[model samples]
Target: MAKRLSLLLLRVSLGGLLLVWGVNKVVNIDHSMAIAENFYFGLLAAETWLPVAGVVQMAVGLLIIAGFARRWVYPIQLLLNGVSLAAVIASVIDPWGWFLEGTNALFYPSLIIFAGSLVVMAFADQDQLALDARKAPAPVSWKARRDCGQ
Candidate 1:
């Protein structure tokens, strides 16, 4: 019971953070684009795709919180985070002034949230408080039922 509860809490917390970040993309689009600038390249500009990205992120977050399909959703989320983290890392060639310039505060918090996502992925199997928890009824034996008179 405790394990299930802890797993649920972690899932909820991680989902909530993603939800906020996703929604923030839509609500404060310019800020989002600024952050997404790190990922921008070729035709993948934030201005052209941030809203769609926001929707996908928000949906993924909702599914995580609702525990719809932890096996699938958790992995998808990990991939998403991995891509974002890679973009951040790829963009920053040096950290000489990442702190003094005040970028660490944002980047580090994102790294922590990414860490939380990792924890959620690890415990996804123990999830109990979720839509997917509805177990199907066991197969009923017709012979046994008839012998018992309905």
Candidate 2:
């Protein structure tokens, strides 16, 4: 029960973070473009694709929050977060700018977000609070399987 609750909290928090960022990308194009230019090599025609990426990210975030289609959503979330993390790896490694010029203290949270996404994906089956959990078939015990002589 504790495990389930913890996973639920992590899932919701991560989803919420993604949703907010996605919305920001759509609503504040200039800021999103700045971030892309600074962190993502201008994102290759970002003016055209940023908002589209934002919409897709928003959908993935919603699915993650609802714990729906976790098998697909979890991996998508992982990939998205992984890319973001990779972009900020310098800040994560030297957030104080001790040796890196572009490092920022604020970007360190990307590490935590990435870790949380990994945890959610690793424990997807244990998240009983997820919407899909209720629909999942119960696991058969070893005794039952043996009795059936499979």
Candidate 3:
């Protein structure tokens, strides 16, 4: 179905994005530290936060790609994306300069990812091509439910 295909594409693409971003944070801690310094990530030192946050980001991406734990994974991913988006959006003192300057690349891309995160959360159930689907049990009859308790 077109719906399934679309959801699949979104899921996979977002997963890849998260994975890469996470790895980038880990690999380039100095860069992440610099960004964090101004982006409300000042609570913790970059050396302590970036790698740990990177691991969480990588895990969220892996779970989204795996598609086996939508009930929990999707929400966590949404929270992560929402926080990141808010930070980036708030950091831009000059909104109109998003495209005019080289320093503001993340402004729009992060917006795109934030929107994608919402879309992914909204249609997480349509992911038929996921691990959860293959592992799910068959639907039970009403009679079975009644017999169990109703």
Candidate 4:
């Protein structure tokens, strides 16, 4: 029970952080685009596409938190964080010869969260807390059913 509680706490904290970050991107899309522009290039430049990125983040965060779509949301979150970490590394290198950008050290926290996600994926036994708890049904057995007359 205590272990389950710890897992629940981790899931809620991680999920909440993602939801907040996703919402921040959505609410301040211009800022999001600016950051994206600084970190990325080419096809990611379109202004309209920028907001869509935020929307996707928001949706994925919600799904992960709700435990409604782990199989999909978990992998997507992994890929998202992995790509973001790569972007941070690129910025740190400044390969184009421009001055290196100040590291926000965001990647470390994200990597930690990514590790947490892996934990949840590996041992969560399902979603996390109330969401999965509520979804579970009582086990059925022939003896119980026979005693209760079905």
Greater-TM-score candidate between 2 and 3: 2
Quote the positional error of residue 30 for candidate 2 in Å. Answer: 0.5
Higher-ranked by TM-score: 2 or 4: 2
Specify the poorest-scoring 10-residue window by lDDT in model 3. 97-106
| Model 2 agreement with the true structure over 54-104: per-residue lDDT tens digits | 888899999999999999988888888898999999999999999999789
Order the candidate numbers by TM-score, best to worst: 2, 3, 1, 4
lDDT string for model 1 (87-145, tens) is 56522433445444423334544566667789877766556677787655777799988
Cα-lDDT of candidate 2: 0.89
Question: What are the Cα lDDT values of the candidates?
Answer: 0.72, 0.89, 0.77, 0.68
What shift in Å separates residue 47 of candidate 4 from its native position after superposition?
2.6
Query: What lDDT tens digits, residue by residue, belong to model 4 across residues 11-35?
Result: 6676676677677676877777777
Question: Model 2 TM-score?
Answer: 0.88
Q: 34 in model 2: Cα distance from truth in Å? A: 0.6
List candidate 3 segments past 4 Å from native. 90-95, 98-106, 134-150
TM-score of 3: 0.75
TM-score for each predicted model, relative to the true structure: 0.69, 0.88, 0.75, 0.68
Q: Give a tens-digit lDDT track for model 3, residues 1-150.
A: 898888888888888888987898899988777777777557444597889988888998998898868788888877877777877774344556655443464475777777888887776666788778654587999999999997
Instruction: Rate residue 94 of model 1 by lDDT.
Output: 36
